[model samples]
Target: MLQGKNIHFCISERPIIGEVNIMVAPGELTAIIGPNGAGKSTLFKLLSGDLTCNRGEVSYNGKPLAGFKSNQLAKVRAVMPQHSEVSFPFSSWEIVALGMINDPAAISDRDIQAVMEKLQVWHLRAQAYNMLSGGEKQRVQLARVLVQVWKKQAFPRFILLDEPVSSMDVALQHLVLDFMNELKQRNIGILMVLHDLSLVANYADQVIMMKHGEVMANGHVSEVFTNQNLESLYGYPIHVEKHHEGLGLLVHSLPIHHINQRINKAL
Candidate 1:
């Protein structure tokens, strides 16, 4: 498991993320959801060790994140930031291959091909990464992260992603998330920043809702995704209803004007 205890971060004496505690356990898909400026990405960086916190601790399994050497950490966790740029003319295949740079020999060409094909980017393998469409590039980057933790290890490993499907169409979004479900079977923990509440409602095993750098709610989706919790988190009149299609839930928000009329009547 990956855990953070009372994690805090600041800039110029102003806290960006403050006293946040979280746990990502193996075999679960944990999602962090919030409106804009909620410090979701900042918290993600702290957990990924991209940015050191001013106070508190982040650990993988039981070891402090700081204690792990670069190579060792690579084996335990793979991260996909919200934005990644490849200025050079690297081919899609080459970009994915970089994931195994620590020890390329560990993963074979066949395994690499399988990953690329699975992501529907095998045909784009020879194409320059910079030339691909936004959704295509996203898939390629995801494939890279997959390659890093492709082989199963004896201990738990993790993948940290931020707004992973923001650029994709609805079909692609479902495709990518479905594959994430498959990863859970391999005992790999997936922690991602998600903006789509519908996706969070349908797919996540656990959810963390944040606002103004604080955790508004966190727990199993069924608990944290209530109408009241969501309305408070988003500061809007939202509804959480049972999905007629299946066991999942459907979340929607009323128009601001409509909510104001109801509030006025109550007052």
Candidate 2:
């Protein structure tokens, strides 16, 4: 499991994140959700070892994150940030191949093609990466990260993503997330920062709701996704409805009329 204990970070002596703790258990899809300026991205950077924390520590499988050598770390976790740029004119396949640079023998060319096909980017394998659309580029990048931990390993592994499906259309978003769900069966922990509560509601096995760099709630989806918790987290009136057809929870903001009535009554 990947865990953070009392994680703290600061900017110029001002605290950005404080006393935050989280756990990403193997085979679980854990999501972090919060409004803008809630320090979601900063926390992500801290957990992925991109930025060392001002205080506290992060560990993977009981070992400190700082102790792992670069090569050893690559085998345990893969990270795909919110945005990635390819300065050179590399083909989509070449960009995907970058993930295996640490140990090319770990993944085969055939395995790479299979992952690209799963993401529906196999046809664009020869296309220039910089020339693809935003959503298409996102898929190619995801393919890159997926292949890093695609092969099963003796020890558990993890994939840390930041708003991975932000650019994809609705269908593609589900497709990518569905693929992520499948990865859980391989004993890989998945942690991502997501804004779409609906996606979080349906796809996430565990939820971590953050506000001002503090954890407001963290638990199984059913326990943390209450209307009350969401409203308090976002500072807006929200509603969570259970679908009569047994689909799942449907969440939305309260209607404008309801907001006005509540305000009038308070006054």
TM-score, every prediction: 0.95, 0.96
Q: In candidate 1, what are the lDDT values of residues 5-90, reduced to their tens digit?
A: 99999999999887799999999999998889999999999999999999999999999998999899999999999889998899
After superposition, candidate 2 runs with Cα above 4 Å error: 254-258, 261-267
Question: What TM-score does candidate 2 get on C-alpha atoms?
Answer: 0.96
* Worst ten in a row by lDDT for model 1: 245-254
lDDT of each: 0.92, 0.93
> Clashes in model 1: which pairs?
none
How many clashes does each candidate structure show, in the order listed?
A: 0, 0
Distance from true location, Cα of 143 in model 1, Å: 0.3
Candidate 1 segments whose C-alpha is farther than 4 A from its true place: 257-267
lDDT of 2 by residue, 1-267 (tens): 999999999999888897899999999999999999888999999988899898899999988989998789889999999999989999999999998998888899999999999999999999999999999999999999998898889899999999999999999999999999899999999999999999999999999999998998999999999989999999887778888899988988867898899899999
